[model samples]
Target: MGSAAADALLPLDASRFAAESCAVVDFLEVYYRDIESYPVWPDAEPGHLRTLLPDMPPEDGESVDVILEDVRRHIIPGLTHWQSPNFFAYYPMNASTAGFAGQMLSTGLNVLPFMWAASPAATELEGVVVDWMARLVGLPECFLFSGGGGGVLHGSTCEAVVCTLAAARDRALSNLGHEAILRLVVYASDQSHYTFQKGARIVGIPPSNFRVIPTLAGSAYGLTADSVHEAVKADVADGLVPLYLCTTVGTTGLGAVDPVRDLGEVARQYGMWLHIDAAYAGSALICPEFKDYIDGAELADSVSMNPHKWFLTNMNCCCLWVVSPALLTSALSSNPEYLNNVGGEGAAEVVNYKDWQIALSHPFRAMKLWLVLRRYGVAGMRAYIRRHVDMAKWFETMLEADERFEVVVPRRFSLVTFRLRPRHEGRDDMEALNRKLLVAINGSGRAFMTHFVVDNKFVIRMVVGAAMTEMRHVQDAWELVQDKAKEVQATP
Candidate 1:
């Protein structure tokens, strides 16, 4: 190669790589150390980041030192520090040293294990880790590879839902004929994630066939078997086939848990697929006390949960297990001349995860979960979860002590939903007041929280599951909330 051509090529020298890697690690360490000093939510508005950089890609590669400086000055300010202990908005995106190390290893290797033979070790490791997770969470053997069922990792619960729904849809259509696709129906409570409806639409289930069963505040937002049964009965009477039923364990808004066992029975009556989305609450099931929440998971056709939510794993890792792998593979598997058929004759022995999800290309996400499990053993993880739950209880106790605020719903897991009590008589606009209070709190940048409206009432949701969150941080957040509440209340 010519000197200029060689110079233009990206550097792969071992020494330089190591130095740059170390520098990046140093920057990460400093960021972690000082994360609490920064705002949980950034003050930047839309299109603010475009002004920080040139419109075009860099003409030449720059040193890591220079790039790191740019990240500190320009990028960091715009980022919402999801890792900050003060961040209580949405669900926690937990990260740990071990998970980060696994991420680095995966990035460095950059191998795609779409098929078993594409990367044997990667595929085998994924099987091992997913099995380990299933066992740790006390899942039934029916959901394990050893028991004829298996699991695959997807980037998010939405992808998992889409894949499972496709499987269910195809299975029903196969029996009822393709013409029945228009008549196939899907069901979920109103509190269920919107992903189910999106999945239904993607899988060709008609919009009118999507049934949203309403739950009452009297039932604490839990989806009851009677509601699902009634919905299914109505659909069946209308000549629509019930193809799928989705239940939630720790719903997003109020942390409501659908009665899985009863709902499973209702689904079984009509031969409908039962899916349990335990995205945020599944990690808590590793603790024995929370096991009852998923007592009927064995009856589920497929179960999905996001390890990225609260399992101390980094961004984007969802584990999905199914009682029947053939259904998923039949619906999603695609083989072409360009792609090698690794599982030639005895395909049952091999697991090509590419067939079990929506995407053909996937990263080594199981590595991070494996690392998190190994680094923090089942006992350690249980303790971590317990600490967060205890802190949430502490926060709830504080809220109860104050007459100005009311707990909107019973505390479930580590999420506490509460709102200020109405101070005036004959007022129906407390929603506006609560909205203003939430705005003031978020605007202050002391701590960040998000709101949810349940049963015509607005409530602030405080999730205490960040890896670095401790009792002190929770206390500080409560104090900030109290101060903000007073300021908002004094306004009129």
Candidate 2:
């Protein structure tokens, strides 16, 4: 520290902060209100922002107005507006008002509550909120903190998978010896998120030992227990040990839900740990009707879901619960002299969240989730989800009535997978035709959608779960698809 360098830092002036924050709030209000006017996907090329910015960092502190002006000029154009109601790409990562308010409050407080000693309220609030969520979603009692199991919020589903997989790996290795890691296997359906395989690799599970059981259209791409059993049987015959099975509640590509109860039975029979990844569809569990989808959740060793995706929580919030918190603490906990609490009086009662994940320091993520839950209550959240599901059903009905299009799979949650039927008889390239329609529709900037391939058939996925999306946006998107399909069909 030189005097000049220190002087460059912004002063801790409360009045200045208040004025700057008001400006930021105004900018964001306009940005969110007019989000639809922007393209769902940006037209900017790769490295576009780099070309527009200065090559070097500014040597001097900049005024708030100057920084915000640059953000409007250079940054806004390059962003793909995920908040836009017309945006129907991947599963929604909604940013509700309550979530944002909580996030802002957390940032203002800027607390890193890695352990109960660091910030007891933060740690305690996290545990309370996650348990509250468990009850709301009808999760098994074993996954609640009071029941001995526990939950922790992670940055994403991938981190949760990795942590749970690591715990399972450690437990298996303890009994089978470290060298037996090569013989231990992990299983997941092909329709499951790629995070399972990625998590396996990250946790040192041999690539060859990762088994991806193929899912069939006959079952709507749901992973069946029979398929998992057959895979495990083949692996066992080859002298391999089944260590873990990942069953999905709502898969990413097609919103397929594996039978958790049946799969858990198979996992238990083989002494394997069963983990459920319900990143998208878990929010629907708030309603009693969707509770049946996760009927076998009691058998799971661990489960995870993303509130950011559908529960009106902003990005970077994933809730993971395990039937045995000790498994995670034993696998991931690190003891360091500098980080220890002063006294051991409440050691047994306190939760050191740092022991629950890969990172030793994490944001006060529970604040946003607590706010979302409190602001909406369970009934409001359920109604919010139902609105999206209703819109999706309406879109599915519209597609079924039109002869030119075919609903690819049953509408699950808020996603509808559909495709334009083959125009000419004996045409074998329907995939290419459907892909062109998607490209054109997205290119028009009137609306946006993404696609998935089911049984080699290209299907367009219209996800209607964004916080601001309404029936009107869905109707407009359907008309756009129909108009684009007509153009695509008329062309060579």
Candidate 3:
């Protein structure tokens, strides 16, 4: 009776399972090939998706064909199509077919790579890919495992910053216990991403201890070493311990780059942990000319960069390298009975990634990164980056030529920040007009862009690195911006 019941519940045969999987693969292939690009924003409203999906689970399992049909009808139309070439908002979150295929293969394998013994190839591939990335970015040898330090791949730069801050906190507490280090201070520029402060808060650092250094208006929006030094000195004078300094190779708002070499010197004098958050601009270091932005990176105790941002990889891949692995491991390491294995006999013979960050069951993401690097060799990656940088400069030139628009920040990397010039009468209301123009431009849906508030004025940001973006797309985006500006200005 049990055997008969099992037979009734199961599919016809194993062949049926194989056929279903193949059908799904074929559907995905056709879907990806045919619907390559879609509008960034759908014409439908928020409730459109919910209305299409069933409110309750089906009484019986549906056929694969029915599920595929539902996916095509309901889900496909609702997606924002981030891979679309017309997407120029924020930083590039582009993915290549190669990377996607790698992800697919990883999913098929479905291995939990928490330890080296769990999946040897996965662990080793992570080590090798990170080393390759470190070399491409011209990181110091000290950050490589071979040179006493190592790297790990986290989900985002936020996690990287938090983990590094935790390590820095532990190191400081080792010298001055947690109770004594209550007055520990951290520093970052006002232009820095809010993630730095968020990280500080997660690690128990008080808001008062976080210093937002000031950036001069004419200084390309970079954090000056003098300001950082002065802030540290003031904190010390007030009997506060200066623990860490977070510098940005490229700020989120305007692609501002803090002076790394100078900041490195300041951090050294204060014995502070210097962690460079190069999440956006770090990929450009693969090109020889851009390496100068991180000249003093060697002095940094830790650094993080997101390959998923600029490289042709998908989202959720950030590489964090430390000058001392022991420091990071010590802060996050934990031991448990079931986790202990024969391979982990000696204290130095284990590598359990669960201790590194805030999660345990991480997807096998390193495979896609390895595939991206292998498929697109170092030269190929650099070429892609160079194209974006060149296009950004072209956009800057176009803005400069149009005497009506003013480039708000210095053009660094692939991000161009500009706004329409004040109405020639120098009216204080020009900022509001520019904000309206930005809204109109994005509302059109033909193109997508984002705006940032700089010095209390709204400026539209043009980020040009959508894997498939070409000179033609850049031209179209700029034309859209100009036309929208004209339309908005014509009103009243």
Top TM-score model: 2
lDDT of 1 by residue, 145-246 (tens): 999899998999989999999999889988889999999999999999998999899989888889999999888899999988888888889898999999
Give the better candidate number (1 or 2) by TM-score: 2
| Location of the lowest summed lDDT over 10 successive residues in candidate 1 | 340-349
Model 2 C-alpha lDDT per residue in residues 1-492, reported as the tens digit of each score: 457877766665788888999999999999998888888888889898998999998876677889999999999998888889998999998999999999998888889879887888998899999999999888989999999899999999999999999999999989989999999999988898898999999999999999989999899899999999999999999999999999998788899989989999999999999998999999999998899999989999998999999999988899999999998999999988898668532667688889899999988999999999999898899999999999999999999999988888898788999988778867737888899999999999888889988788888999999899989999999889989999999888
Candidate 3's error at 321, in angstroms?
A: 0.4
TM-score of each: 0.97, 0.98, 0.93
Alpha carbon lDDT of each predicted model = 0.90, 0.91, 0.85
Measured by lDDT, the strongest candidate is 2
With candidate 1 superimposed using the best TM-score fit, by how many Å does residue 140's alpha carbon deviate from the native? 0.7
List pairs with backbone clashes in candidate 3: none
Model 1 stretches with alpha carbons more than 4 Å out: 1-8, 341-347
Question: How large is the C-alpha RMSD of every model relative to the true structure?
Answer: 1.7, 1.4, 2.7
Clash-forming residue pairs, model 2: none
TM-score of 3: 0.93
